[model samples]
Target: MRRSIAVCTLALVTAVGCGKTEPTTPAAPASGSTSAAKPMHPAAATAMQFLQASAAGDLSKATGLLTPVAVEQLNKQGMTIAPLNVESPKFIMTRFLVTEENEAAVEFAMQFQIEGEQQEFHGCCVMKNIGADWRLAGVIIDPGNGMEPVVQNYEQELSPPTTNPANTVANPAGGQVPQTAQSPDVPQQR
Candidate 1:
């Protein structure tokens, strides 16, 4: 009983730890700024808004600007993909540079917990102008963590890759149980 209690406590702590929120600089001003408020560009503003929504797991707001195909794909995988994130991102404004194009690109960094795993997602996203709002076109999820191709951060090193784990069941006792979606409770990792 004590073992089980310890495990459950650990699991909950891990989950809560990963879900902690971080701050991010959405944009930077080009010239002498009066206030701390960043100047807004319709295109860049649209792009940043979409990213913020996505990062917060508020997919509905983000998808309001998505192309049809993207929406459809997400819906089809809705069971497995929770559009909500486990945590918020902390972005460095100095690195938040925007490109000049109908296609908008912003490079930034963020770290958070999702499903008990703490991860830092840093990359660039390309946006296409869809009427007034910006739509996601392409994303580069890998910037590489100065180590190997797959080795980006320590948190990743600690977790196992999401390949098919041989049949492992969850114990009501859950220390480092490493619960993947394949658990009997979670119905759609496949």
Candidate 2:
């Protein structure tokens, strides 16, 4: 599980890190500024709204923007819609595109001050079509510090292996536990 999470986090970081960001410039006066901020895509906007609601601890509003599966996943994970441990959180969208016929992926970087220290983390939210609306289906955030990936929302279903452990050898040192090798294709359990 740790390896898989690391690979996924690396992939997302690479993808978002590869994008070219514009250099910041001094803002013009509101009355004189002609260029308005570009509007977010409808699906991305929904994602942003969900993030905001979640950070604000607005459970009803946050859950309203999530799929039933996501809600159930959060319940299983013992996670609640609560305020984060950071202050002045700012979100910067890195990518927003349709990933499939009825799915969209929104990649973002969240910057905030944690105990007077500035920190940033990256994550992605997947939105799926539900009739005429798009709802959050999955969310994965890497909060660094070697912490476990925060899979706060739904993704693929998880189930225990149906059979006993495979590919193990007895320890030569008379240890009771057998030594086992992990396959790259298999995700390890926490």
Candidate 3:
């Protein structure tokens, strides 16, 4: 079941979105507020509900919050009905990484005890905003490997100023640009 969860998580990260959606930048959290002063966004709350239901061994409730695709992913990973064996789970934080009109990405951190040892899982989930409802489209969690899940970097991927090496101009400074072909804009040395 643990392996299935991890595998499903990996799959969901890359499989979240199917339609092109404009990204909405979340407001910066107020200084000194660990979880921010604002109420959780609906999409993020949906993800939290899913995690809570899973932790509490309520598979039906958890699945109810997931999109059809997410449920299919769980079924494919052999997690259709199995609930996570987590105890004393507590959400540490939740932040919206990408919030669009029809989709939102939520980054979350939670601590729980499993097999009598405390463990922390931190990752992101993408939620689809349906009419008057939010459903989890995908989820990706870090399984204690000490590396953050890549979903946390979605903002950078969607941000402007996307750089392509071929289009890059040589630095005016002494630093050499790493490229096989010189930029067309730069004068070729004789």
Q: Which parts of model 3 have CA positions greater than 4 angstroms off?
A: 1-38, 71-81, 146-190
What lDDT does the true structure give each of the candidates?
Answer: 0.45, 0.62, 0.59
Instruction: Look at candidate 2 and tell me the lDDT of residue 175.
Output: 41
lDDT of 3 by residue, 1-190 (tens): 3332343344444554333323333433221123553466677667777777777788899788877666666666555535667666776434564434577666666777767888777666767877899887656676657564443222112223434534445442236655557788889999
- Write down the TM-score of every candidate: 0.45, 0.60, 0.53
Cα lDDT for residue 120, candidate 2: 76
lDDT string, candidate 1, 41-65, tens digits = 4544555565666666776777775
Please list all clashing residue pairs in model 3, or write none if there are none: none
Query: Best to worst by TM-score, what's the order?
Result: 2, 3, 1
Local error of candidate 1 at residue 123 (angstroms): 1.0
The C-alpha RMSD of each candidate to the native structure, in angstroms, is 16.5, 10.4, 13.4
Weakest 10 consecutive residues of candidate 3 by summed lDDT: 151-160
Ten residues in a row with the worst lDDT in model 2? 24-33
Backbone atom clashes (below 3 Å) for every candidate: 3, 1, 0
